[model samples]
Target: MSSTPVRPATSRPGAARAAGWVAPLCWVAVLLDGFDLVVVGTVIPTLTQPEEFALTGTGATAVITIGLVGMMVGALTIGTLTDLVGRRKALIGAVAAFSLLTLLCAFAPNALVFGILRFLAGLGLGGCLPTAIAMVNEFTRSGRSGRATTTIMTGYHVGAVATAALAIVVIPSLGWRWMFVIGAAPALVLVPLMLARLPESASYLLAAGRRAEAEDVARRHGLELESPPDRAAARSGGAGAGGAAATVRSLFTDGHARNTLAIGVTSFMGLLLVYGLNNWLPTIMREAGYELGRSLAFLLVLNVGAVVGLLVAGAFADRVGSRLAGMIWFASGAVFLALLSVRLPTAGLYLMCFLTGCFVFSAQVLVYAFTSANNPPHVRATALGWSAGAGRIGAIVGPVITGALVTAGIAFPWGFYVFAVVGALGAVALSVTRAVRPAG
Candidate 1:
């Protein structure tokens, strides 16, 4: 099919305005992802209480792990599907799957059923981020992908902040299931809007040997299509084992292996810090003797810092490169996380929590930004998929460890220390990768 039609690209301002829908639509999808993922953490306290879900520490951790397992699978599998089915279809399918699954979560009869629903939801959750990143990168003007990634990622923090705020009000009154109900509501609004407004990736079209479609897309977005569509490569790079296998092989060929391995390691460390904190920050804060409200509010404050970090880090990444910005953010994150070990006044604690979120969350995103910026255009989608999938090891482990710590009653001081160490490791990982890029 020809690319989604737009006004002729002759007028610069007109073409720019016409293409404005890309970032915001992707932002909405990312926002929903942030909301869905953060909701589990926001309601963890309620779920574990004696009179409610009565979930044990181990069971709670298992729930999180199960979900992450699905996420890992989704990232690895559906990411390949995007290359085959087109970005819009894959993205919309992912959002639809997760949204519907999230709705079912409210009807889950017990923890096991709820966990299953969450697991399925994780499939959608896991697939959305990288696909969104790839699409956003493709949609932006040349040399601006890093900035676009960071800006679109701000939707994630905004969703986190909004959902956490909602939790403060809803958990006590309507109970936790209602939170899932609200989380599912986005599909109704977003899917139609996405279908109406979201354009398929021109890069995907070009790569797939759809020159006419690619050229149409390029014209619509004021982009130039380079090289006729590579149909042979596209067919050979089809999805499933045949395609994914070759793409994986390509990564290891032509000196890409070193960089690939380095990013994998960095992604693992960075995600450990991200998923760990996202899953346990409230619980950790609460166990530190903060009031429950304050603990939940810390989630809000932390995500507020995340939004700020996105803005600051995005600009810096655009100028100095995502690798250096990631290193700086990770180092700063380590220091702030370590400081959480000390009990402080309310103001001091809030400030630290905000700053920790600012650095820790953005640090991982910068890793993603770096991955998006550095890889070969042909293999970029696959590389991102694999990097994110590899990182899910940390996503799976982080919550489990934090859960065990919380169960052991050491989540406050010790948890922060552990996170501090992970943050440092992430920084080092990113630093190591910087020296291992493709030899020109």
Candidate 2:
């Protein structure tokens, strides 16, 4: 219906054309996800205004933490569901779930109601990124995976930047509730498009022994199917039960367990920094003496830097391994985050915010990259799902701690320093994971 044919394989005559559309479509979905993810933060400053929402510090922080906790559950539960079901179905379901809940958030009667709805919305939101990342990685050529992922992920920053702009335009005119209302709008637009246009992951189909379906997808997309290799053939040589068991077992066999734990820890720290800063940056900066306008502007600048960082890291990760690049990028993030604590001129603060955004936003992305690289094709989704799921614990902790500190009268500089420590811990966790290799 959309004029784009579905080419499922990596190398077909029409593969490029089909991929051209697929990548952008997936990116758009991710953009919507990012938009909803950061929209609350964009609206937070307005929400905290006594005349507006009259939200207390503790109440505000509790709402954010509750949403993140919901996201944590969503990430773990939905991620595994993606492996069991198909990526396409799982993704659509997630979008629908989050969208409905976002609509609920727009009309919440109080902070308590808002917090609960946001939490439900967050579960859907949490499931989206890892599933999209896994789907994109599987769809692209091995060598091009990093670029494809990063390019797509740029949509996330773009969405964040857009939310900041929208906040400036919409919040003043329509009120903060309109922000959540806008967040729900995308689900309406995207869900129908996804159901009609998005295709099942070829890898998923093949793994499920749905060859006819796989072939149909490839034919529609004009892609070539790789001949079943010796490894695949041997694995399937036995009954389907053996192959399924072998796939699960291989995830832990051959030294993958240590790598799994390392990736989990790294993801934990990376998300801690990401969610901590993203959720609290405006509040932190406002307490640091910035006006509401200036604080929101800081968020825009940070996301601009995030766009740059994702592009740079994606290009670099392809050349050096994702592991090394992630380590370097995260280490750089730590340096910049630490630097943000120092009182600087207004211009200097903006510059530091930009630099911090560059490294901090992409650091979490690198965790996804590392998860993809460490696991074999069969268990890749599971690995990413569990890693991201585990990481949500840190995500939950970051905002709670930061908000508590703010409530306790901790200085902005010290709050940032605490985030910097988390970044450093991420660097160490990722570095330890460097030796992990995919199971053969």
Q: lDDT scores for all predictions? A: 0.79, 0.75
Cα shift from native, residue 180, model 2 (Å): 2.7
Report clash pairs, candidate 1. Answer: none
Error of 1 at 133 (Å): 0.5
Best by lDDT: 1
The positional error of residue 72 in candidate 2, measured at the CA in angstroms, is 0.7
Candidate 2 lowest-lDDT run of ten: 1-10
> Going through the candidates in order, what is the number of backbone clashes in each?
0, 2
Cα-based lDDT at residue 432, candidate 2: 83
Q: Report the C-alpha lDDT of model 2 over 14-62, residue by residue, as the tens digit.
A: 6557645567667877887678667776677777887766788677767
Any runs in candidate 2 off by more than 4 Å, and if so which? 1-13, 44-54, 229-254, 282-294, 434-440
Q: What is the C-alpha RMSD of each candidate to the true structure, in Å?
A: 3.8, 4.9
lDDT by residue (tens digit), candidate 1, 1-440: 11121122445666566567778888988898679667887777788988778999778877767888888988877776776667889899999999999999889878999999988998988888888888888767655666888888999888877888898899899999899999999889889988987887776776565658877776776665544533444553365677767766777776677778878887887888888887777778789887744355666788889888888898898888888999999999999999998988889988998898889988888888888777644466677787889899888788778988989999989999999988888888788764333110
User: Can you give the lDDT of residue 353 in candidate 2?
Assistant: 89
